[model samples]
Target chain A: MIRFDRASKRYPNGREALSGATFEIREGEMVFLTGRSGAGKSTVLKLIALLERPTRGLVMVNGCNTAALASRRIPAFRRQLGVVFQDHRLLTERSIFDNVALPLHAAHAPLKDIDKRVRAALDQVGLLDRAQALPLELSVGEQQRVGIARAVVVKPKLLIADEPTGNLDPALSMEVMGLFRRFNEVGVTVVIATHDIDLVKASGLREIIVADGKVQDPATEKLVVPSMEAER
Target chain B: MSGWLLRHVQSALFAAGRLARAPVSTAFTVLVIAIALTLPTALALGIHSVRSSTGEFANAVDVSVYFKRDVPIEKARQLAASLRQRSGIARVEFIAADEALKQFREQSGFGAALDVLEGNPLPHALDVRPKTDAADPAHMESLRRYIAAWPEVELVQIDSDWVKRLNAILDLLRRLVLGASALLGVGVLAVVGNTIRLEIYSRRAEIEVTKLVGGSNAFVRRPFLYTGLLYGVAGALLAALLAWTALQLLDAPVARLAQSYGSSFRLLAPGWRELGILLGVGALLGVLGAWLAAARHLARIEPRS
Candidate 1:
């Protein structure tokens, strides 16, 4: 479960990234946050990940207040949630297997467990055979899948992705969203931040619309309506 | 517990693999460190040789106590006998006035001139050889001062001025070696720190990804620390080898020179103790350098959330 209770974040340079935004999502729920560039969607996810602290209100992840988490405990706190980036931030020098095994390595999991989970995660992303290949050798979509596999390799309770399909074509984006759907089906809470209104509606999931550093009412936001494509 | 151990071993192995991937650069770095360390080691060996030579001449550093002209040979003999019982004095040989004059005539080639004198001109004296440990110039000087204070003794001459001068030279060389070693130590640290900084810079993206995925700062730093450690150890071993080879090349000539001087002293190669100390210093510097670089740079690289 994730909750942001009127949380606000202000950059040091007098830019308000988030302004008293409040939201709550139930356990095992998949949610999409829609906002234009610099609308503070990423800031919300960052607060949840304990990467940044809220300037005013409390931010909670899995029933724990992230503001109270010490810097020394951030790594352990981060291990509980998987995060995907828009850039597909895979270590180019390492093989796909090594990249995916990174989380387990960070946790100091047993080597055998790392091998088994890495293979399983790679298989989930349909890239098990490409585990030995470097990220640079893969297509952009494939590299993004590897990133996804890496994020989920630790079986984190919640997964947050920031414009994960921003670099993909429409079909590839759909495929990436489908992968998230599958993860959500298996009781993994998923939250995605994207500006793609059509893609958010097509999934027929709960939508939280952010605009101008504040969350818009879900009923009044036209982009939150289910799409005709979803009805089909 | 076993998993943690395995992770550390894996990180160390990974560092070695990275070094192995770039053999030429790594070799060059190691060579630089070895050369830096070799100068100090060779200088220390030279100082050690000088110290050993000084030790060999310790027994010859005796004090000559001369009695006043009015002091009788019987009184001087009694003084010598009493000096022989002292702790630091190893032996006391009394020379009667007539015997002293005879020796002076034989050595000084003034036989007819000395025979011209009505009475023996040379005073009775005691040649005092100090115990081996007390034969250093400083201790010898102290013994000379103690003897000069005697009521019957007119003067005490210590035959250790040249030895004192040699010791001063050795001391200066030791200080120079220490200074050189400290400077080279800083050089080694800088070399390692720069290398690690570059490595960290090149791998900045990888480090960011590692941190994003829950890797602790210690985990991210482990490999670089190991890299620094390996660099230090390899350099130390190479320096030891190089110093040993140089000593071998010089040993024959040094032995011959000593032989020509009718001395049996030989060059001393560094033993295990010296090697251990060198290796320890190298490793410590390596770790310190890496830690400094990592601490300075790693914090600035938080993942962009």
Candidate 2:
């Protein structure tokens, strides 16, 4: 589960990236953060990942206030969640298998477990046959799939992706969404940030739109300024 | 626990593989380290051999106390007996005027010329050998001054001047060796640090990706640390080989030179313990350089949200 209560983040340059943005999502739910570029959606995900902290208010994940989490514990906190980037972030020098096995390797998993789990995740992304191929040799779509496989390879309880399909065609994007849907069906919570309204509409998942450093309700698509009543 | 061990092993092997893949660059780096390390090692060995050779000469340090020609042989014998009991004098031999004449005739090969003299002109003398610890110039001088102040003594000659000069030269050589080793040590650290810096730069993207995937700073640094360690170890082995070869080349020439000098002194080779220390220092410097480079560069790289 994820919760952000009146959370705000300001950059060192005096630019407010997120201002009193608030939301909550229960376990095993798939949610989309639809926003324009630089709308602070990524910032929100970053706070949950403990890659960044809010300058004001509180952000909580799995009942732990991230603001209070010591810096030394950030790695363990991050291990419980998976993050995917728009660029796929695959190591071009390594094989797809090695790329997918990275998260497990970071966790110091056993070799046998790493191999089995990496294969299973690759299989889920339907790229099991290309495990030996290099990331540079794969198509853009296949590379993105490899990234997805890497993210879920750790079996993180929460999966947060920042514009994972920003570079894919609509068909490929839909396929990626379906893969995430499958992971969600298997009880993995998924939160994706994207500007793709068409994809969000087709997926029919819970959407929280963000614009101008504020979270807006999906039904009305209007800014829900943090109110004292909503602070509860 | 096994998994952790496996990861460390894997990281080390992976680091070695990465370096091995670039053989030419690795070889060049190792050569630089070896050369830097060998210079000081060779100098130190040179100083050690010289010190030991001079040490052998120091063992025979003696001060000759010649009695006045008017002094009686019985008085010289009494002085010798008294000097024998002194703490710093290892041995005292009394040489009467007649015995001194005999020795001069035999050693100078002037027996016919000496037999024509009316009376033995040689003075009664005492040859006093100093203890090993009192064989240096200052100790010998002090002993000479003490003997010259005696009533019957005509002259006191300390025969440790050459030893003192050799010791002074050896002291300078030792200091030079120490300074050169320290400078070369810093050079080794810089070589390793620069190599690691370049490695971090080339793999900047890999580092960023690793961090984003929940890899801790230590995890990200593991490979680079191993890379430095391998470089250091490889460099140390090569330096040992180089030093051995150098000693081998010098061994025959030095033996021949010592033969010409009528002394049998051989060049000293580094023992196993010294080699082990060289390897340990190399490895330690490698790790330190890698840690410094990684800690500085890794902090600058963060996964952009």
How does each model score on TM-score?
A: 0.84, 0.85
- Worst window of 10 by summed lDDT in candidate 2 chain B: B53-62
The CAPRI class of candidate 1 is: medium
RMSD of each: 5.1, 5.2
- Per residue, candidate 2 scores C-alpha lDDT tens digits across B174-225 of 9989998999999998999999999999998998888788788888999999
Candidate 2 lDDT over A141-214, as tens digits, reads 99999999999999988999999999999999999999999999999999999888788878878888777888
Q: List the residue pairs that clash in candidate 2.
A: none
Q: Which residue segments of model 1 deviate by more than 4 Å?
A: A217-232, B56-61, B64-89, B92-127, B131-156
Candidate maximizing lDDT: 1
lDDT score, residue B113, model 2? 96
TM-score of chain B of each: 0.76, 0.80
The deviation in Å at residue B73 for candidate 1 is 13
Best by DockQ: 1
Worst 10 residues of 2 chain A by lDDT: A223-232
